[model samples]
Target chain A: QQPVQSPQAVILREGEDAVINCSSSKALYSVHWYRQKHGEAPVFLMILLKGGEQKGHEKISASFNEKKQQSSLYLTASQLSYSGTYFCGTEYNNNDMRFGAGTRLTVKP
Target chain B: EAGVVQSPRYKIIEKKQPVAFWCNPISGHNTLYWYLQNLGQGPELLIRYENEEAVDDSQLPKDRFSAERLKGVDSTLKIQPAELGDSAVYLCASSPGGRWGNEQFFGPGTRLTVL
Candidate 1:
């Protein structure tokens, strides 16, 4: 099943901090994070395995909690280039990855 | 190495017409995936292939949709009779097989418009 993302959309100014969360009903074995700009493909950000460790990609970071079957993406000091739609793809049983509805992030000047 | 590549970046067809989208994943990448993204939604997996074998296709409609990945390199996704509701972006992604944290790289995607 698809995961659920909170704060469907968020608006932030450059240097602002924002957090996007992805939660699934099923147990999550792995969680993948990606970002897509308008009319573009979703680019790989990072992937978190069962263990609840934090991952960082430039100014963007993510944390995965296997116990709660949830993952959170943290955008620290957001930049204009950070404006896009963020999706968390949850993997179960080591198989196909299912994506969340996505959280649209807008970083204005 | 180049990233996953998709062709006919944009396709416009009338309802009931057949349309096909093609993808060429990064060389040496054994896992290929085809996904559909509706407006304001994340990419949804339609099919996945490991090398030349289709390992997962459970979510595929199977009625008017069919996909094939020949030679375990390039793949094709075809819609026999398209409907207006089929208008969306078709994405292709690939990963270097599967390990603990292999991240899938995506292509530019094909935008399908059914009138």
Candidate 2:
């Protein structure tokens, strides 16, 4: 099943922070985060395995809770280049990976 | 270290016409996937192939949509008698294997417009 993302859209100023959440109804084995710019394909960001772990990328970080089947992405000190649509994909049981609707984030100076 | 590559970035065709998109995955990647993304929606898997074998294609519309990865390196997705609803972005992704957790590289995607 497809994951559900919260806060359909968000606008932030440079150096601000934002959080996007994704939840699934099924037992999640892993969660993947990606960002897509308009007219471009989605870019892989980071992946969190089923161990309720957290990973960081530069200033971006994410936490996954296997028990709740939820994951949250955190963008710290957001930069203008961070403007794009963010999606969280969840993998359940087997190799099935489903993406969320997406959250559009606009970062301005 | 090139990423996945897709051709004919944009295409336009009338209903009932046929359209095909090609994709080349990253070298050494053994798993490939095709997904359809509609406007304002997330991508949905159309098919998945492990090397030259199609291990999962249940979501593919076998009636009008067909896909093949002949050499296990390059793939082609075809839509016959295309319908208006088929207008969307087709994305190709590749990963090392199913054991790899959510680490897939994507192609630029081919946008198709059906009139």
lDDT of 2 by residue, B3-114 (tens): 9999989999999999999999999898899999999888999999889999889899999999999989999999998999999999999998745534888999999999
Q: Assess each prediction's global lDDT (C-alpha) against the native.
A: 0.90, 0.91
**Residue pairs in candidate 2 whose N, alpha carbon or C atoms collide under 3 angstroms:** none
lDDT of 1 by residue, B1-115 (tens): 7888899999999999999999999998988999999999999999999898999999898999999998999999999899999999999999886464358889999999999
DockQ of each candidate, alpha-carbon based: 0.85, 0.79
How much is A94 displaced in model 2, in angstroms? 4.2
Stretches of candidate 1 exceeding 4 Å from the true structure:
A52-56
Q: What is residue A48's positional error in candidate 1, in angstroms?
A: 0.6
Q: Considering only chain B, report the TM-score of each candidate against the true chain B.
A: 0.96, 0.96
Candidate 1 per-residue lDDT, tens place, A5-107, comes to: 9989999999999999999999988898999999999988888888665444766678887788888898999899999999999888675799999999999
How close to the true structure is residue B99 of candidate 1, measured as C-alpha lDDT? 63
Candidate 1: DockQ? 0.85
- Which prediction has the highest DockQ against the true structure? 1
